[model samples]
Every structure is written in structure tokens, then in C-alpha cells.
Target: MWSGEESSRLYALRRFVDVYPTITKPDRHVRFNEKMWTTTFVLIIYFAMTNVMLFGLSGQALDLFSGFRSIMAGASGTIMHLGIGPIVTGSIIMQLFAGAKI
Candidate 1:
């Protein structure tokens, strides 16, 4: 039998990924988008240097990016990792409808 906390956690996770396909584009890039810019080499070096700094700065940035790694799989995984929670997703639906004045 599942504990109360476990059941709620499962339900909460399910709700966060519950979004419709909006009329707008969901994302513009994938991971390792080195081709998106003309300055690929420069961006590579910049990313590398940032990694060096992040590795030396107690690694909080790395931890954050590790959370974002799920986004590489696309939006469902992204929402799951974010744990944006149930009420927030419901609120966003209301927000979009309000914006549309519907």
C-alpha cells in the first residue's frame, strides 16, 4: 500500500505535466545547439570557461543545470523535473484564458 505522502507526490507530479499543446511554439532549441549561432567556437569557449568557474564556485550552478537536463528530452520531462506543482499548472490555464479574454 502506498503511503499518503507517496500517493500525493505521484498525483502532484502527474498534474504538473498536464498542459495542452498551445498555439505557440514550445521551445526553440535543443541541448548542444552549437549551430544556432555563427560564433559557435566563441560560445563553446565561453561555456567551457563558465563550467570551470561553476566547478570552482561550490557547484550550485551545476546542480541547477542537472535539474534542467531533463528538458533535453522535451517538455513533459521538463515539467516533471521542475516540480512546478499542481495548483500552479491550474493557475496558468486560468491565466492564459484571461489573457485571451475568453
Candidate 2:
């Protein structure tokens, strides 16, 4: 349980975090070229990132999410280790909040 001051501070922190530009479904339709270019760029970045191995990771270290590799789109012990996890999670949270009218 949080004290009153702690709760207020937490609320403020939440507010601060929420006050950022989020990737929302656009009000206006995107042009085909724009969509294509955006997608291509993102894919290029993702693929490039996948090839980047993390430094100082020992080969003998175990991957905790090896089973979920296909679903997560990340390479074990690489820069893409968290692959799409953060993006997917944030999307789900936002969708849930929107559904709940929060």
C-alpha cells in the first residue's frame, strides 16, 4: 500500500509518462507510397537490428525466451533480444484502455 504522498507522486509520474506522442491510428488515410516506404524502412531497420549481436554475452548463456523466438522476432543474445515485445505490449495496453473507455 502506498502512502498519500507516495500515491500522488506515482500518479504524477504516470501522468508524465503518458504525456508523450504515441503511435495512434491516423485520422486521415495514409497514401500508398507513404505506407509502403514506412513499412519498408521499419522492416529494414528490424532486419539490420537482428544481425547486431549483443556485446559481452557469453555463448553458454541460456535464452529464457528461446521457445517464443518465432513469435517474438528476436535473435537470442542479440540487439533484437526483446524483439517487438515492447511494441506489442504497449499496443495491447493502449487497446485495452481504449476498450475500457479509460
Give all TM-scores, in the order shown.
0.19, 0.49
* Candidate 1 lDDT tens digits, 1-102: 867776665666765566734476547764455556647776675445333332234423335555454554322223333444666988999999999999
Worst 10 residues of 2 by lDDT: 6-15
For residue 48, model 2's alpha carbon misses the true position, in angstroms, by: 2.0
Kindly report which residue pairs in candidate 2 clash with one another: none
Best by lDDT: 2
How far residue 44's Cα lies from its native spot in candidate 2, in Å, is: 1.1
User: 1-102 in candidate 2: lDDT tens per residue?
Assistant: 767776665666776777777888989998999989999999999887877777898757887888776786767877788557888999999999999999
For residue 78, give model 2's deviation from the true position in Å.
1.2
lDDT values, one for every candidate = 0.53, 0.81
At residue 12, candidate 1 shows an lDDT of 61
Worst 10 residues of 1 by lDDT: 72-81
In terms of TM-score, how similar is model 2 to the real structure?
0.49
